[model samples]
Target: MSKKHRREEDDEHPDESWLLPYSDLMTLLLALFIVLYAASSVNISKLEELSHAFDNAFSSGINILDKNALIKATDEQNKHQQQRHEDVGARPNKEQLKQEEQENLENLKKKLDSYIKQNGLSTQLQTQLNQSQLLITIRDNALFPSGSADVKPDAQKLAVAIGQMLQSYPDYEVIVSGHTDNEPINTQEFASNWELSSKRAINFMKILLQNPAFDPKKFSAIGYGEYRPVDTNNTAEGRAKNRRVEVSILRKYTDTATDDTVLDAIAAQDQKDASTASP
Candidate 1:
């Protein structure tokens, strides 16, 4: 009678094994809720503690990655985005491009002036801005020996720097001109001032063109030997001033002149150097 009663009780109760998975599912849901609450509250210590506990309790085959890794990835992404934004902001637009030529010329002048001042090259180098162009005059001795067209080794850096600056506005026409005092010359390499000046201009231009960023089509070389004198040839100082190499960055649209002629724009400097040596 007892056995029959026990079997009837089992039939009415059904199998209880199905409750194991349901209870496990409830535990997993509870763990998820705990994790979400801890994470939302920024309680990293508590969240790590709960994660470890739940991992041990429900050790099937699951793992939560370290929060630091996720945080690091997010930080890197933000930095990259910021850098891209800065680059875009720094780039010139069409309106800025139209005005950049003038602004770039002015900024280049300032940079050159700073370099000249820092290096104490005031006597050997100077810059002039006129209606037609931007003129950079370098004394012959700065880039060459007494009568040689070869550029001085140390002065190559200056050429490279000027080239770099000019590359910023590559569309402008650049003229490298060589000048000489009234003194005559006769050598195996150069027969007269014309040849000497021409070689000097060509060599310097070659150095300037060494910069790959510079467009070769925008460059030209001229030899104004004993013709265009910024100072008189009567005195030693005047002669020294007359011998020079001129790098002129020509304006793209000039109604009048092609060269950087000393117009009234830079007349004050001429007046200042009057009866004196000028670059």
Candidate 2:
């Protein structure tokens, strides 16, 4: 009877097999909470390591936490975004640089114009500041004789003054171009207009380079002969205008069509003025 009573007592208690799964669920929930808390402070790599450890310990191989991967992806995205911001901040803006360059050219032009007007050189020389260059046009009579390539002794002073002014701008490239009228020439020294124009350009450039402040490597001489005339070759006055020398200081920030557009406008204006004065 006692044995029967013990069996009844054992049957009165319930089976506890469900506690095994319940305990496992509770442990997983605790691990998830810990991972979530740590993820708020740590990088993605550490979270991934912790996830692997939890997966190994559980032995069920069931993926209980996908939030770690999500957090890792978010972290990587933020890192890339910050890097892009830094890159953008480090570089200079293109439009700002262009504006600064334009201002610098304008100031230089003002200085040159003031010097020319003060010295009463308006008739013999003129300066034009355009998008691609600063052009200084000089009448041939001011620098050379009627049929010679040699620069006059007194004209050396003009070159010296120009050189002094140019000393302030050491970074520019200066091009000295010689132009002539359509009249052909055959001298003992020069066989053709091309040779005369080229020699004239070279001689004038040499005088400018005499200043110690001028960089010889930055200067060049070219002759367009009668091809690049600013005026007509039909009359004596036009021919006189055509026979000239041009000193071009090339700009550092040049645009593709800006130079041509500005030059064409200036040339058109000059042509209109010349035509108006002709008759």
Candidate 3:
């Protein structure tokens, strides 16, 4: 009688081994469908994973039952791979940097030219771009008195404007060089042309450095005096041409081969100056 009573209790309980698994499968399917709805456009690999997940969720076969958590782990693994793909482990190469430097110098040249034209200082200011440097030549009379080193108050604006333009390119080496005609000067304030030229360069450089955006180590002042004359000293016109200050923006990158084009431009300019200066 006890055996029969136990049998009756077993029949009432009806083996519920599949119920738990079925409920878990239903939950996974519902979550997967929600994910699918959010990401309607999936790649081929994603579609394959979803299909495999659906097969497992439906209890389709015993073959894939051992790795039931394959889909759950796949998401994390794919995400890790994606992050690695997004990481660009490359930096700009030498040629790329050279190209960028060229473009920047060109742009700065254009800006300077526009500023010169707009300010009606074309006669006193000129720019030359070469493989070696970006040369800006300014007549001494524009920045100083007949024999003075002190910059005229109005000309400080030009210096400041140049300084502001240079702020955009801070890495370059800048040189403020003063030049003068062959005429010898022995004033109370200046003993010789050397003293006058040196002070002029120094004063102009000081004004530029006032912006504080520049690295002082990269800046320098040079005094060429009458040593580097681009024009003849015989005539008044040539002397006027020779007395100038030059702001040379030294180049960081150079071409593999030599470029004599800048020399040609200088020759052409000299011819022009000589023709105009001739009496």
The TM-scores, one per candidate, come to 0.58, 0.63, 0.62
Report clash pairs, candidate 1: none
Tens-digit per-residue lDDT, 30-141, candidate 1: 7578668756864454456555655654585543334664465456656866888899999877556646667777888888888899999999999987656789999999
What root-mean-square deviation over C-alphas does model 3 reach? Answer: 12.8
Q: Which 10 residues in a row give candidate 2 its minimum summed lDDT?
A: 270-279
Q: After superposition, which runs of candidate 3 have C-alpha atoms over 4 Å from their true positions?
A: 1-89, 259-279
Task: List lDDT for all candidates, in order.
Answer: 0.81, 0.82, 0.84
Candidate 3 per-residue lDDT over residues 68-129, each given as its tens digit: 47655476659855875666335666788888988999999999999999999999999998
RMSD values, in order shown: 14.7, 9.7, 12.8
Tell me which residue pairs clash in candidate 2.
none
Which 10 successive residues of model 3 have the least lDDT summed?
61-70
Instruction: For residues 1-279, write the lDDT of model 2, one tens digit per residue.
Output: 999998898899878999999998898899789768867887666576666656665687745556675576567767866888899998878777778767776777787788779988888898888777888999999999898988988788888888888888877899999999889898899888899889989999998998888889999999978767677778899889989989998888766688678789879877775564354
Candidate 2 local Cα displacement, residue 7, angstroms: 40
Output candidate 2 Cα RMSD. Answer: 9.7
